[model samples]
Target chain A: MDSLTDKIRTLCTGLLKDGKVDMIVGFKKGTIPMSSCPCVARTPEQAKELIWDSNCTLNLANYLTNRKEKIGVVAKGCDSRNIVNHIIENKVTRENLYIIGVPCDGMVDKRKIRALFNDDITLFSEENNKLFVETASEKKELDKQDFLKNNCTTCIHRNPVIYDELAADPVEEQKIENRFADVIKIENMSSDDKWNYFNDLIKDCIRCYACRNACPLCYCPTCFVDESNPQWVGKGQDINDVRTFHLLRAYHCAGRCTDCGACEEACPMDIHVRAFTRKLVKDSCEIFDWEPGLDPNKRPALDTFNPDDPDGFIK
Target chain B: MKVIKIDKQNWTGGIDKSRENYQIFGPVKDKEHFVFKKLNLKEYPDMENALSVLSPKSILFPQSEKILAASLDESQDDHHIMKRVATDYSPRAVIGIMPCDAKAVQLVKLNFDTDDYRDPYWCDAYEATTFVGLAVNKPSIYDFTLSMGSGPFAEEGLDVLLVDCKDHFLAKVLSEKGDAFLKASGFTSEADADKSAKLINEIKNQAEKAIDAEKVKTEKLKEKSLLELHGASFWEDLSFSCINCGTCTFVCPTCWCFDIQDETKGKKAVRFRNWDSCMSPLFTLHASSHNPRAEKVQRVRQRFMHKLKYFVDKYDQGTMCVGCGRCVVHCPVNIDIREICNTMNSYEAEQA
Candidate 1:
């Protein structure tokens, strides 16, 4: 990973020095351990601060929305897909973006790691497939596979679909048999149980909108929740308002979502926000035989019309 | 001040007894994190737990509250005229509140309860409740209370400071409210004052030492002009990762901003005060469809400037932060306040 970090820094530095882009957006080592925050480097010296680690969980495509500058962005598997979605949606032009792609393994879930200790995790480092965690009272070595984020564990895309440059050799993608098993479990529940399940899932929400803000798909200048004239959702934490916000936000991302897991990662309450979007992901796949962001020239399933499209659900 | 020795065996019974007189609110295990909620008959506060995910500020200022309400029907005498809504102001006690959170309540009081104006809702709730703070003997890595003018064991805004001494708790009664609550709980076992004070002093020093290295210099902030710090070049890079979400402000103990809205059902209309954040795009939006802090950078700058500069200059309080570290631990993009504070404190504007 250190070698990967050095390679990325060198690539970004050369790009900036040659005036290929105005800025390079990448991850920088955070003040706290196990945190890599998004950063924009405009100089060769600043580019040297870029890092590559499992802690880089946020989607970099979020910074590319309607950006005018010729920018070089570091993209992992999910980020590159979102960038394709952005290009197809006219959020960013392909000529302006220099995608430095990374073949991702997976990101570790901080919530899972924090749950293991009663006190704060003083030190966290990763090497190969092992995680070294230390606290004031205890030290433990754990398997990285056991601590991968839920979305990462089931991901089939380990290599970027589009990239101008490669950070490392491509890694083999996972072959999961039952990708939609969790969604199926919810689908099997009774209507009342489903209602109770979703209610309980989002009951802890504080309406911070972290999930919405973190997703690259949520690039509206004025989100529906913010519209005051004909407000679509209330501003309070009422259960009904929270449900409306989550369901409506999910519907908006019906076919465009790439299962980036940025929403779940950015949620402060650790809510499994993907539950809402995963259903849409499965629906888009089964009904339209579609997967989003695979081709930049192709329109999304929901945005286009076709004679063979499933219309049984319309009734 | 009197120190009461509460044995572990008597703790539960005492807490149960207190329920007869006051509604007990304390930290309980809520799924993944601890939260302050009303306790049932046998549910005691999780004293061994670390900080709650959200502060106990909700006890005084809820996330959503009804400040005023009105009806649209003409049959009512007060039809269109808004009136104060009814709220519960019963006697209650917040048990096991963090010392930093207790101090945060006092800092927020500067805004809600002032000489010129008093927020009726906040003042009423504050006057009706007592704050029983729990001492943090084992401070987390994120805790910087000592550096922010409060310490793990500091008892500035608490009625009583409860220190966990392994097998028993050393309850240091600080006010008349503390005494009355203890008496109501039937906890009259008083320990030797001099010896208990020495023991608490030792523990306080140890906890404070753990966070001593986190001290951020804010004296330089006082010397720099507000415009100079506001227009600092570091603001852009420092706020690049901000997603313009309210995660930081929502979890913060001292963030006390709210937005008012009215909801209508049939002929009834009720106004509500909902917790609002400076991170939101609409926070500074005017009725004329113009927003001053329209850009994400401006919104991000406002949060820090208000916390670190504006509040410091206006109220002369050290800063409007208790250093409870909730914002640090919960920020999705890892936007740390400690780093921002240090940057603002040490910033020297380039001479023109």
Candidate 2:
């Protein structure tokens, strides 16, 4: 892991000194204790500040959109796929970006790691292929594989889909399998049971809208729920309104959602909002044989129209 | 212009008599408040009470409707797909619509029609409906000036304008549709100059009072740097208690975000559009699982900024709120937009 970090620092410094890129966006030691946050490196000296390890799991491609500067970004297999998807969506041009691809073994779930230490774990670090966590009075060493995030465990893409440079040894791709077994299990249940499950989940909603704000694809100048001229839903606690909120969110993500799990992670209520999203991903794959963010060449299903596209709900 | 004298007692009978042909939709007492309902003379007993909680716009711009449907069969001749004809609209009359709501319909018509990019779905529904505007005699729940401009009577696009006075009602015919409806209803009396003057004075006085009472004091807030105040502690304090349920935008009269979906059952599928909001994290989630506005503060800022800034930039309108106080009253934690605006305004004033 230290060797990997050293390699990243050396490459970033060389890229800046050579004027290959103006900005290098990567992970920095977070101000908030034990957190890893996005940071920008403008010079070779700033490259020393870049950190990469089990905690560096956030998809940093989100910062590339709406930016005009030539940027070099660190991309994991999943993050690289999203960047490619962005290129296809016309959100970011490929010519301006320099991608540093890293073969990922998946990163640790910080939330789970913290909970394992009973929320008292203040600081932690990776060394010698083991995770050393420090609590108030005690320190513990655990296997890195034990703390891997759920999304990383079954990752099929261990190699970057798009990269101008490689920082780590590449791993062979794993065959894609049913990644949404948990979501489908719940879906196969009775409608009443499904309703009960979602009702319990949605009832805990605090309406912070963190999920929407965090999503990179939710870029719109004006959203319909804010329009007043023909107010579609009332600003009240009507269950129908809440249902409409969730249902509409799932529908919008039907073909476009990349299944990054950012919405679920940012949610304070811990509602399994991803359950419905996974269903949409499953449906899209089954019906269209397409996965979002996987290819730079393909157009989005929603934006592309086929006169022969299925439509049977009208009477 | 005509002054029709139908005693309050006989008004129900008149509505009931009219229901034989036209569908009568009006305000009916619902628990402690009134709501728009399909008026049946036997069930809905009140006419001149309060405005229904919901505007009459939905009769034309429905809350949810199917736009297109199709069936696909892979087994039949190499994936054969069939689609159904679009839904047909029936002409209907919406009575007791407020002047602001009538104006809103006209706004929808202008946007949905003039731009070569027209919303055929909305236009088809709108064309089949007749707008019967009711002038307000007193201030109801919504304060018109804070949101919509002050107006009590429709200037255009109204089939019939019903002006309620203390003694009798003055009905103005604005279009051929209005004249034809009145003629078919078998009632008529030409309005004199004195009656017209009285009705005009009453409308003007009531509208002015409503505007004065509900006017939002935004001068101080407008002076502050909105960008500088983006990450202020005020937002954290206000949003801390919120549940993030999306009730505020759903109940708001002006919120119009929508989502399109495809539903398929037994080889049949249909595409439909439903309402959506910026408050959900999934609202901006990309296919790659990247989100930009990932914080609660950003989401809260968007709601206010879009209302006060973006909408004004898009449409040449100010004050994106009606001061209906519904968001304040309906929000579970009582996070009020008015209170936020006032607090920001005061903070700006202090800085200034």
Candidate 3:
């Protein structure tokens, strides 16, 4: 059987050669270990640069927003869902995209792997379910499942919701118990405790806006924080300003987020940014019974208004 | 120069004792990663910390600072007039700061302490702080400090350099501030000067050897014309992965760009200087709604050009990077500055 990388390259090369897509969006080998940066491949030769691995953590759907060219995008389960959301939002047209869906084995958290050693991780590679980490002094072999990203641990969508082609057989989605345990723990706190908990969570945020930029849904021409005329949020490190930015950003993606984990992966501070969005995800699920991006034909929970919608908090 | 031997057992006590006259800051474990924090009496600096997520630049230049303030009231004297905010310029010591970060401070000084204009806030804060650098015995694979003209044992900007020797630290005083700090800590046990110097050199050689394996050409960057490099075709592909986030700039010790903003709340007004990144869309936006670098590629190009070309040409001091590898390690999309530097250095413009 051809590896996923080989299959994707072969498919993308055929697409580019046939002039099916003007470009192919995918992952390329990164400069350092446990990283695969996004790349744009316009030719057959460039398409060969595309690789599929556990380190392909970023959402490739982000590159598809408002693009003019016909694009063949390599998408994981999360990326495909985001593409559906993009189509629904009219950020991209369904006709312009050829999504090569990947049945993903969860991405490994680089931080977790890094924590296992005192020295730097010089090289990281995976085989089967095992990960090999090498440093100057020693080499360690560990289970990939043990180092999976937090979002990947509870992910129920291992197969893409929508795809033009499948790179491999669909992965078995794990049956997760108490998926919102962390959120429930926070919800059980008193209002003051919750306030303090959130404050402590974002204490290290430098207001770099990596979280906002990494998000596929945050394709606004001008972010609310950037508005100067009656500026919504102050451009300082003030606690209130920082809190406001996070709160408003989470609210913007309330019902539209697909739990892609791109924001947390992009953060340099290693802050648990998902702590803000996860609550909203739970609320959207519990109240509206809405899960975004499962179907391109369906409107977002926030976009459509129903007569029987919950209005208990209106007063 | 003086060399003092500080026993490992006395480290905490000496650090505590120095707090009487100095506000000490050092690297401490902050949740998952390490960060420089203001230390209380009980806390000790983690001298062996592998890396700090953010550099010690925030010590002298905070992420946000109030420079001026005023009253908007009509009846009061000195109303509607902005006055420089009073700042605490007391003595402080930054212990266990990496040599690259210390060099970064000096690189930033070129902008803050120029011949024509002097930024009082930066210069004042810089003067108040004492930099005590910790020599890197084991350089990370990402660290390319030696290629950028600063090394594991570089002492360009530090007042003192501390070498870890298992049982004790060998402190080599490089400036008067270091000597004063040692005296204040009551650490007067002088090591054999010649022996200590030889030991430090041995450690430095080993560390530099590990760093010397990596290559990043910057000497030829001087020969290349700015326009030729700026118009290079590689930037488009090079910048494709960039998300235009401020992670690289924010974590960088040498990046010193700032935006001045005024906020008015009720009858009180304040002017703040906040750290800004060229990667931001608004960084170059004009008041007339015109944007010079509107595209993401342009913003990405500007960051590299400024760091690798513009600053190098203007100062003739080298690239604006100290090669601390913070950007390399922290960039979400893995945009490596080392690769960019090499590309810019060796780039040749096609004939027109």
Top candidate (lDDT)? 3
Residue pairs in collision within model 1? none
Descending-DockQ candidate ranking: 3, 1, 2
Report the CAPRI category for model 1. high
DockQ score for candidate 1: 0.86
Error of 2 at B289 (Å): 2.0
Whichever of 2 and 3 has more DockQ, that candidate is 3
lDDT of 2 by residue, A1-315 (tens): 777788889999999999999989887664333456566788999899887887666677766777788999988887888787779878899999999988887777666775565324656888765888887566888888788776676677778888999998897766657777877798789999999887876764534454554455555534444444445654334466677777787787777777666566555445667777778888787766777877788887777878776666555
lDDT by residue for model 2 (B112-145), tens: 5766777877787777666666776554433443
**What lDDT does each candidate get?**
0.91, 0.65, 0.91
Please give the fraction of native interface contacts (Cα pairs under 8 Å between A and B) kept by each candidate: 0.80, 0.03, 0.85
Where does model 2 sit among the CAPRI classes?
incorrect
Better structure of 1 and 2 per lDDT:
1
- Superposed by TM-score, candidate 2 places the C-alpha of residue B155 at a distance from the truth, in angstroms, of 5.5
Off by over 4 Å in 1: none
Can you list the residue pairs that collide in candidate 3? none
Judging by TM-score, tell me the better candidate of 1 and 2.
Answer: 1
Which candidate, 1 or 3, has the higher DockQ? 3
Model 2 regions more than 4 Å off? A1-315, B1-10, B13-21, B30-33, B40-46, B49-51, B74-88, B107-111, B141-147, B151-158, B203-207, B210-214, B218-238, B340-352
